[model samples]
Each structure stands twice: as structure tokens, then as C-alpha cells.
Target: MKIVNFVGYSGSGKTTLIEKLIPIFCAQGLRVAAIKNAHHNFDMDKPGKDSYRYRRAGASQVIVRNADRWAMFSETPQGAPHLSELIAHLDPADLIVVEGFKSEDSDALRLEVFREIGRGEPPICQSDESICAVVSDKAREAFSALPVLDISSPEKVAAWITEKLQIKGIEKC
Candidate 1:
């Protein structure tokens, strides 16, 4: 499986871009999975729910399921797991899109989303060697060495990803 990490500032539209790309990949018949890094103390299960109660009752892992789907919530008291560790838990897929973990030391390919929202900080791709491209609201000329993709065109981004990664989906035939 191939993996690409979308690294950018909080408001760089990483989530929005990923949301748009998922369906495109799916249409191409490629399985896509996403991993997002949430801030500390974030909770997925509602309080007073059975899953919540199990977690609160000292269960290290909780699996909640219904006819439609199932999710497993595992407690990691030792702090956040490494990207590789988290990836291992997911079922196999054609591509894995990771959000956040910009500072992670993994060798995974990174695509930096850049937007000029008055944030003085420079794009991480400027200093990060792992970044393969820049998806931005600006024009292509704004970037120096790396390829600059239009953020408004997610289809183009999706096409670029498949081409760059050499990932082909099922044949339409």
C-alpha cells in the first residue's frame, strides 16, 4: 500500500481537500483510508454511552459494532503512537492519507497544503525534504522547485496523486 501525508497549518484546508479526494479515488475503484491526528483529550464516543462506560471502566480497548459498521477505540496512555504503528492497525488499502503529524520522522511522502491566510510562518515544504508537492490557492509561479497544484481543483490533485504514486485502480471494463 502507498501512503501520503498531508502536512500544513491548522487552516490550510487539509481536511477539506481530503474529503473531496476520497470520492474521486473511490470512483477510480481504489480503496482509500485516512488517518487524522486529533488534539489531546479528544473523545469520539459520547459520554454515558456503553462504549464510553467501558473505556471509563478501565478497558484498554473497546469495540463497538452494529449491523452497518464497527469501530475499535483503544486507549494509549503511553502517548500517541507512531504513524507506522497506527497504519498497521488499518486494513489494507490502495492509499492512506494522513492528516497532521507534520513533524513525524517517517519516510512517507508528504504533500504540503499552503494558503496565505496571514500566517507569517513559511510553508513546511520549504524546509521539509519529504514534501513532494505543494497544493495551494496561489498560482504555480508562487512555488520555486516543487510542483504547485490548485487547491480549488481536487480532481487534478487526485489525478496527480495517482500518477505520482503510480497507483492504478481497477479497470473500468
Candidate 2:
């Protein structure tokens, strides 16, 4: 599957952009999957729930299912698995949009998101050679060497991604 990693500092609109792009891709009948990297501890199951109780009661993995959907929760006390290892567990798709894993070296295409209003941090594209393009809320002439996309225009970004991957249709199941 084709992969693209969107990296940015906190409050840079990475998640918002991804949310907008998913539907655009889906509307075109492409199978799209996303992996979001959480920086802190998080829980998907609530307290008193069976899956939560099972996990707390020493079950290494707990799966909760219903007619509509299912979710798998696994303990990773050893440490978080590498991005590639995590990707191995997912079903194949036409595109995989990764929201984090900015520091890890990988073959996935990288797009750096930058917003000038918040964080006031320098763009990662300055130092990260793996970045293929940048999406920003402001004009970034300094990054003239790379393709710069407008943050408000997710449709253009989605089109760029589809063209880059040469995606024509959904992958066969």
C-alpha cells in the first residue's frame, strides 16, 4: 500500500487536514486507512466495561465486537511497536495516512504541516530530507525548493496524494 506521513508540531492542524482528506478519498471509492500516533497514554475502553475488566484482569489482549464493528486492544508494556510492525497488523488498502512517526526513518512519503500562528517553530522540511512536500497556513517562500500546499485546501492535497500514488480505484479485497 502507498503511505504518507503527516508531521507537524502540536496544534498545527495535522489531524484536521487528515479528517478532511479521508472523506475526499473515500468519495472516490478508494480504501483509506489511518494511523495516529499518540504521545501520551490513552485508553479506548472505559472502566467497568468487559474489555476493560478483562485487560485489567491480566488479559494481554482484549477484543470487543458487535454486529456493526469490532476493536482490538493489546498491551504493549515492552514498548510501542515500530510503525512498520503496526502496519503489518492492518488490512491492505490503497492509501495509509500516518499522522505521526516523524522521527522514525521509513520509506513512506512525508508531508510536513506548518502553521505560523501557533508554536512558532521552524518547519521540519528545512532539515528532514524525506519530506516530499509541505502544507502550511501561511506562504512559506523559504521552502521554495519543495512543493508548498495551502492548508485550507484539503481537496488539492488529496488530489496531489492520489496523483503521487497514481491511485485510480479501490484495491481488490
List of clashing residue pairs for candidate 2: none
- Every model: Cα RMSD to truth: 1.6, 2.5
The CA lDDT at 61 in model 1 is 99
Instruction: Single out the weakest 10-residue window by summed lDDT for candidate 1.
Output: 138-147
**What is the TM-score of each predicted model, taking all chains together?**
0.94, 0.94
What does candidate 1's lDDT look like per residue over 58-105, in tens digits?
Answer: 999999999999999999889889999999999999999999898888
Per candidate, the number of residue pairs that clash is: 0, 0
Cα lDDT tens digits, model 2, 35-61, are 999998899899999899999999999
**What lDDT, from 0 to 1, does candidate 1 have?**
0.89
The Cα error of candidate 1 at residue 24, in Å, is 0.5
- Candidate 1 scores a C-alpha RMSD against the true structure in Å of 1.6
- Point out where model 2 deviates above 4 Å: 170-173
Q: For residue 121, what is the lDDT in candidate 1?
A: 74
